[model samples]
Target: MSIYFWGLVISIAVYLLVGNYAGRKVQGLDDYYVAGRKAPTLLIVGTLVASFLSTNAFLAETGFAYDGYAFLMLALVAVNTSGYVIGALFFGRFVRRSESLTIPEFFAKRFDSRAMQVLAGYTTVIGLTAYLLAVTQGGSILISDVVGIPYGVALVMVWLGYMVFTLYSGSRGVVLTDTIMFLLFTLVSIIALPYLLGEGGGWNATLTALASSEAKPGIIAWHGLTGEGALWSSGKDALIWALMLGASWSLVLAVSPWQTSRYLMARSEHVVVRSACIAGLVLAALYVVLLFGGAAVNLVNPNISPSERVMVWAGMNMMPAFIGTLLISGIMAAALSSCSTFLSLIGFSVSNDIIKSQQWTEHKSLRMSRYIMFAAALVSLILAYFQPPAVMWITYFAGTLFASSWGPVAFMSIWSRRISAPAAFVGMLAGFLINIGAKLLDNAGVLSLPVYLDPFILGFFSNVICILVISRFTQPTKAALAYFETIRQTPKEELDPAEVKKTLIWPVIVMISGLTIAGLLFVFYAMPYAAAVGREFSLFSGESLLSIGYGLSVFCVGLLAFWQVRRVYGRKTAQRATTR
Candidate 1:
């Protein structure tokens, strides 16, 4: 076997060992479902990032950048990641407060609707299975190409690698191993970036060359390529598309079953909030590097077929043996992390929410969940075999299901007093069916959608319309209203005086870091680009504003977070004083 193959094998072996070890502690459903609800900020952050920064991001989305649209993807990401903060603040903390094992159950609890729970679980299975297929396919392709394995065999290997740990250890195993994988991939992303940049003649020369190259004109332009056959009609269209999908994806970050479900494992609401903040920061940094590497690899070799192999090609051809090995393994780690996460969630929904397994004996429930996970993994493997890899689009399609279906309902569930269970159910169903149906039509060429008013718009509007119309006609159930009130209160565990004090530090650190990054960007990124473009490298240049604008956005997020947290804390203190 190649060293890369051995590296992947060893990585899987270690993760298997770690997962089995975690399984030993799974005495009950709590341990299996949500890590006994005791995961700290670090573990939460690790899983959030690991579960998210999968092969879909590394291979599929990065390939989109390599195909031109690097900065456009970055713009979309900046819009999407804002959901982390909004989600953490509004939706995720309440989820932790509810103490549900799965997001489906959270909906069931919030509205007291078992059918809604099952429907949510049904969508979860369908959407996440598609996502799993994409990740598996991406991993299989990487292994098949670089590790010299047949695609069929590689698919099975990828399936078994994640399924073994997930079936055994559940969330306990997933979180711990996910953290480890997260660290590995994060390190490789940092280490591999400079090498990729150096090969492309550093950022300055690479930017100038990409901008000027006649063969791939506008490859590094603000909106990426434009005119005929471009991804969009024009630069403005690209911006609108980025913004539009960016908003949809933002909702995905907010209330996607996979993203919000991780909160159910957090130690406290504070951990949920802190982890979300940190994950947003980490993603901002990681995507810029990862996407840049994707665009930069064109300089190394622009003719890479399928574009998904750009990173792997650059790793093998441009870097040292060990670094290349590590890079491949890192990408593999990302694939496995998402696979395990999605697989475990599928099983949790099947056994817990779909089958109502809590009524069974503890041993039977655990055994059944494992069996269900194995079944889900097998299903995904079969799907992977037939589906030629279209990793990025597959992911985007799956992701839209949640944002359109769950996003509006999620926030309203926490804050709205009148959204009835029936209304929510219709809204969720309408969004799911409309978005998916439109996507199918669009894919089949029965109809085409503009960049701005594509499938997501149809589903999102349908959801909102159904919700508003139905909610107006039907009053909320008393039970639902009471549950809403129940979750709105801060949990006793999170209200500790010292903990509140610690939270104050988060906003301050975030704001300062944003300012520092903005300042550093002009010095490092803007000035260099300006020099390379034959323009005066000045503080007031348009390039400088680009960095500064992003930095200010981060600073604003921190400021808003700081203000809200203080207001909440102040109210809590006053309530206590009045009670005394």
Candidate 2:
């Protein structure tokens, strides 16, 4: 084999060995499912970062940058990071304290109904399956591009790699391997960004080239409905606003069910809390680098599309072979980490959440999970082989469906005392059906909703309305109220000695510091470029009191809202209530 191929093989083998070794202590379904609740903050953070930075981001986002500008990356980063902030400030604490094995488990506990479990399990599995296929296809493309392998062979290899880790170590292996992958990807992104930028030109020169180049690529322009490439446009400003609001809501909502299993596996609530903070920082940094890479691509070429192969093309064309190899490996790492997590998650839902509930023995249950994993992976592999090279909009549709169906159910199950079993059932079912219809319509290209009124937003409101309307007519059972009381009244575990040092102060400091740096970068680098290119941006210069006053007014209002939430919920108590 060539050196590049050898390096790829060696890297994959090393990660697999290291992961399995570190996760050897996972003893049973509990450990496999929840990692024995022993993960530290750093490990939790690493897995969270790796899980979120999946093959989709590498392929889809890069393709977007190639076609459009850095705006797509910037838009998504802002949206997702805002979701993290919302989660940490409101829902993260609650989720950590819930102590449930899966999102369905939480549903069963909070709603006092097995029907909710089965329903949620069904919705979660379906949404996750779509995401799984997306990851698998992306991985297949990467392997085929880098190693010159046939798509079928690459698909099988990817499936085998994921199955091995998921079957043996479960969530334990998922977290450990995810962490390693995150670190590797971070290094590669940093290395690749500079190499690409230096090759293209220094920042200023690159910006000039971009301005004078074909079609002014790299500017935050958009396609309205009457304009070019209008998928469904609100306006030039509509893209950012829709992306920031819609995408942020989806992230928070999806993370609740999607990552709830991993969060429940945390050693302690404090561990998960620290992990969330760290994950946010890593995500913010990763976004910045990706934005830079996207901008660098604009300096080289425009008219790029959002596809996995596009990223590989950019790396190979722009960077040295050695550097390109490393970046490809990093992208592969992202793909593998995401693939393994999906396999484990779907395996858990199918076996524990569905099949094993019919009374399989422990040995049988383990075997069942593995079998299910194998089956799911096989299906994903088949899909990958047949998938078109064009971008798939259904992946985001799946994400939207997940958010709409589970977000309200998750939020109410823990926080709202008024939510009855009927309410929960109606909320989940109504939201799910609406999202499904919208997704199908979108796929059929029949009726595209307005930018702000897409299926996710529609379904989210449907869920809210279902809960509110149902709750008014039907009173909550005393038992359901008692469950909410348990969540609210329970005292949190005291921090361990090691946790005392690692938990509260440093995490806060690090997160704040990271946000500050990201904000500064946005202001100094991102904002200036946007303003120069006829984008809508405002900044305060000396004696521009009007802008300063407006900024302060916005900040003050936000602070007041936060203060009210704190007063009513008692600092992270809203999250605790939601998780309950």
How much lDDT does each candidate structure score? Answer: 0.85, 0.66
Please provide, for model 1 over 134-227, each residue's C-alpha lDDT reduced to its tens digit, 9 standing for 90 to 100: 9999999988988777999999888989988899899999999889999999999899988888976787777777766666666665477788
User: What would the per-residue lDDT of candidate 2 be over residues 1-580, giving only the tens digit for each residue?
Assistant: 6545765787689768966785677667777777777788777777777877787678776665555445434544544554544454355555556676676766766777777877887887888878888887777777877778887888788777776777777787788888888888888888887766775667655554554444643343322122455333334444544474446344553354656566777776566555665565566567656755665676555545443466687777887888887888888888788888878888888886665555677768877888888888878777767876432354566677767877777767666888888888899899889978886797689986656667777788899999999989887777667767776543445323344445545444553554465455545454555554555664542112222332232233234333433443345454555776
Candidate 1 global TM-score = 0.96
| Top of the candidates by TM-score | 1
Off by over 4 Å in 2: 216-226, 230-237, 244-254, 301-307, 389-392, 490-492, 495-502, 506-515, 522-580
Worst lDDT 10-window in candidate 1: 213-222
Candidate 2 residue pairs that clash: 63-306, 94-575, 94-576, 414-580
**Model 2 lDDT, residue 83, Cα:** 51
The positional error of residue 84 in candidate 1, measured at the CA in angstroms, is: 1.0
**Ten contiguous residues with the weakest lDDT in model 2:** 541-550
